[model samples]
Target: MATRCCIAGGGPAGLVLGYLLARSGVPVVVLEKHDDFLRDFRGDTIHPSTLQVLEDVGLLDRFLRLPHQEIGELTADVFGEVVVMADFRHLPAPRPFLVLVPQWDFLDFIADEARKFPHFELRMGARVTRVLEEDGRVAGVEVSQRGDTQEIRAGLVVAADGRHTTVRTSAGLPTTDYGAPIDVLWFHLPRTPEDPSRTGGTMRPGSMLVTLNRDTYWQCAYVIPKGSLEALRARGLPAFRRSVAEISGFLGDVVDRIASWDDVKLLSVQVSRMPRWWRDGLLCIGDAAHAMSPIGGVGINLAIQDAVAAANLLAAPLREGRLLPAHLEAVQRRREWPTRVTQRMQIALQDALLSPLLARTDVPAGVPLPVRLLQRLPLLRRLPARAIGMGVRPERVRLPPAG
Candidate 1:
């Protein structure tokens, strides 16, 4: 099969790019290795930047109709005290709040919309094994599906296949690992009507737990030092359950739902980015290009922004067959700064806050001074709100839809 663009990975970046390209009359196919988008613990927070893109594409109203919870502000419980972190209500956008919906629902919505255009195709369970190259340019992909492998040539190939991306590695792209001091163990617990409505987490000396309110349940991420899962397991599940209950006392005995280690999913957090994101007919976006820390839950939004920028810069060129190496470089040039800025913030937070917190052995009596200042000066909260909500250099949809 042949098309204008073949995108590896059907996550936020690839699907959104495919949808936009197809809208612009570019034949595009998105290959997802998974049969379904039901994987647990994916980033689900849709920020204001992404919401603005949806509005520009005229899909905001339809997207709002989906079942999702909105968060106006981000708050965290530090040493048994609630600290207001980011206030999203004042963000400059049509939807000035963060939307929390299951990632599968969001992807399905994009896939459904893209199907309206004749040029769009989505192949689920299609795993990309290698890049097809010719004359020193990436030509297409060798994809495996249902016990058969075949070549699908394209004008361009996109490696949106995430951090452990086979496509990017196959093409021999080099990545710079900034390194993370922590990993997260994720699990779910029952949420009740009396449970806190605001989405946030709890932090204590030597331990931290992030709790995202998923309407029916709380999706919890328990942060631990890197390479320490074995030590934690040796301490036993009952001991782990006690630690969780102690930090977020409101959960009470509900923590018992974590029946065994199997109930907890390990997320080995990695923060790294490729010095160069593309070469010839290939480009890498989202986690494939830069793997982010789960600090502000901004990974999904960043990936979506990359897609919007890529589509904006490359759609017309690909449709007219005037694409060049310079066009691909423009995408990296447009997005690389934001990726670097965001990763810097995440790494600083990891080193200055998380690393020290996890290493401490004493219980603190009060919230940190920074938390107190933010709580005291309500106006200061918007700084963080703007950073998390708007991001740096948010992209707008500029490609006019082709009839």
Candidate 2:
């Protein structure tokens, strides 16, 4: 099989880029190893900037019709004090709030939209084993599907295949691991009407939990020191349930819903990025280019932005068959700054806040200084709102949809 562009991984980046490219008349195929997008505990925060991209594509109304929760303000409970972190109500975008929806629904929505264009194709259960290289440049990919291996050649091969990317590694791109001091154990507990209406984080003396209000149930992340999963498991599931309940008392008996360790999924947090994100005929974006710390819940939104930028810059060239190595470099140039800035902030937060908090045994006293400041100067809250909602450098839909 051959196409103008072949994207590996049908996550936010690949699917969005495929949709935009195909919508602009470029033949694109997205290879997803998974048969479906129903994975649990993925990043589900769609910030204002991503909503603007959806609006630009004229799918905002349709997307909002899907089941989702809008968060206009971000509040966190630090040491039992609820502090307002960000106010997204004032962001300069089509939607000034964070949209929380299961990532599968989001991916499926984009996949469904992309399927409307004849130039687009999504291959499920297709794993990209390696990049097909010709004369030191990526020609396409070697895909493994149902005991069959096939080569799909393309003018451009995109590696959007999450943090553990085979394409980037096969292409021999050097990546710098900034490293993270934490990992997250994720699980869900039933929610009741008495629960907090807004999504927020709960941080106590030696524990931190982030809860996303998913209407019926709360999607929770229990943060732990990196490489401590075995220690946690040895501590036993009952002990783990108590720790979560100790952090968020409102859950009451629902914490007991975590029947066993199998109900919990461990996310080994990583923060890393490549200095250069592309080669001659290959480009890397999203988690493949940079694995973000789950600090601000910005990974998915950032990946979508990368997709928008990639589509805007490469669609026309790929369609016209004038694609150049420099065109790939342009995508890195456009996205690298935001990636650097966001990663830097996440690293600082991890090192200064989370690492210490996770290691400490004493109870945290008083509202955190930054939280106090945001509360004192109500207008100051908008700064973080803008940073998280709009991001460092947000992309818009520039390539018009193909008629």
Candidate 3:
């Protein structure tokens, strides 16, 4: 009999897993709660590492054709002094930069690709409320569609849910919260000539602008305190616009372009890691397993990497027999080291950007002059590209061969 895998939460991770598994001839089902792909303000940036994985999976061409933007460099402004942190042009790949595509479109595209495989099934509006266990092994999931509940029996259950993962909690796994004190206030602004290049723009001082198109708009994020969204909304449109203008000097024109309160959206940020990503016959991937702060801009990329790693490792064992704890253990071990390093880096970056004074104060005044000089060198721009390009290598991670 063929292996039956049920994937919970049809986000990028779940959808990609379904696509790869179905292509390898496994029967796969993806359940998503949302009735349609209409979410806004999701992470739209796809790092170079993720792009490489998409190319390997044969979806790069399609991904490129979607309405999107390319990011070339990341810049920082410290007390009115400009510094270039990472430049994508220096990376070795043909396409070294990050791509900014709306998450809804990307998810829809992946779902469409998964549909081409006869073994793949995507059921939107189907929400998995609980995992089904038989004899201490994950047998499947109990899901609800509209008002009706049904049971899906499968050999393996993969959870690709986001930070507040229901599956992770259901399995009784412990999650460690490494909270960052900042949150993100997201909003859209109309395109302006003063904005960075439409295709490969760099973030301007005091604001991060992701240009969507020459004529359409750009997405921006402003760092704020956690739980500040409601207070910000209560401040009303004028105050909100003023706050934006204060943070981003260039926002004078863009604030006027906003025209209405409906254009802005806010997201509270938090970073967390699951102590145990797997239990019994089930496996957790993506933000469900390791939630990272958005400061490093690697959340989506990491999630995609997790999907690739999990599929590569578990596909074969799942094909031959029931999914085992050993297989899940291997997945966690392969991902934990990279995940921890990246999370720590994220905290450091957050400190530098959001609390520069605190970061600077922490450094010794008597630090070596040569080290400070090296930090100011312009050649350091390649660092971001190098970091973004480093994703999980299937060979190193010990993934299974293609089915």
Candidate 4:
């Protein structure tokens, strides 16, 4: 009998895993609760690192053809001084910059690709309610949609669900929370004539803006402490706009344009890590395994990386025989360190930026002078690209392949 792999949550992570496994001729099924891939304000920035992965999987051309914007530079303004963190010009790829594309469109493209494989099956509107365990090992999943429920028996079960993962929770997996002090108030404002330079869109000072297609509207982000959204809203639209204006340094009449509460939406920020990403016959990837705060624009990329890593390691064993506990353990060992390091780095950066006291006065011991000196070097400016592209190696972890 062939090994059956059941993947929960058909987001980028699950879909990509299914695509790779299906292409390799492994039987796979993806269960997604949503009937369609249309979610608002998801992580849309495709980082340079993720672009390389897409290229590796032969989806680069398709991804680039989508309606998107090329992000050239990551600029930060502290007080009145400006700092450019990463310059895409120095990166060695044909397309060196991040691409700002809607998450729904990207997922749709991946799903379409997955459809080409006969072994890949995507069941929309299917929500996994419980993980089926037999003799303390994952056997399959119990899922429901509308009014119907069914048990899916599989050799392997993959949970790609978001932060509040039902599988992870049901399995009683341990989790570590790296608390994020700040949250994002995401909103869109009309592109005004006064800020022509920014009509191209820029991460100005303390705020972030992505100019969505010909600069009709800007996807703007403002930082606030976690759990402060209701308080901010209670103060009303004028106060909300004023808060945004103050944080962003009163960007050229753009603040005045946000007239109503409906214009802004608030999202909480969190970074979480599972103690162990896998157990007997079960594995978790993407946000289910590790969730990073949306600070460095790495969450989506990391999720894709997780999917790729899982597919590369498990597909062969899954194709030949029964899925083993050792295989899942190997996957966990390979993935844990990179996820931990990345999440830590994100938290550190978040602390430095979101906290006013830290941003202004609490410079780390060796950072100030070197940071200043490095800013002068053109080569050093592209460190962010290097960090994303080649900094972490997943192969460092040793794991045995199934015989």
Question: In candidate 3, what are the lDDT values of residues 198-246, reduced to their tens digit?
Answer: 3322232333333244246757766665666677678888887876665
Q: Candidate 2: which pairs clash?
A: none
Best by lDDT: 1
Candidate 1 vs 2: which has more lDDT: 1
Per-residue error at 10 for model 4, in Å?
1.5
* Per-model lDDT: 0.94, 0.93, 0.73, 0.73
Please give, for residues 1-403, the per-residue lDDT of candidate 4 as tens digits.
Answer: 2238999988888988888888878889999998888977787877776677667667799888889878677665444345666677667665688788888988898889879878888889999999989999888989898889899988998999888899888888888887888787677766654543321223333343433432456677776667877876788888766655654553536777776767667678889888889878789999999888876677877787788788878887899875677788887777787888887778777776456432243333333443465578868877766565433552211122222
Whole-structure CA lDDT of model 2: 0.93
Q: Which ten residues in a row are the worst by lDDT in model 1?
A: 361-370
Q: Each model's RMSD to truth, in Å?
A: 0.9, 1.0, 4.1, 4.3
Backbone clashes counted, model 1: 0
> What pairs collide in candidate 1?
none
- Residue pairs whose backbone atoms clash in candidate 3: 312-400
TM-score (C-alpha, index-matched) for candidate 4? 0.87
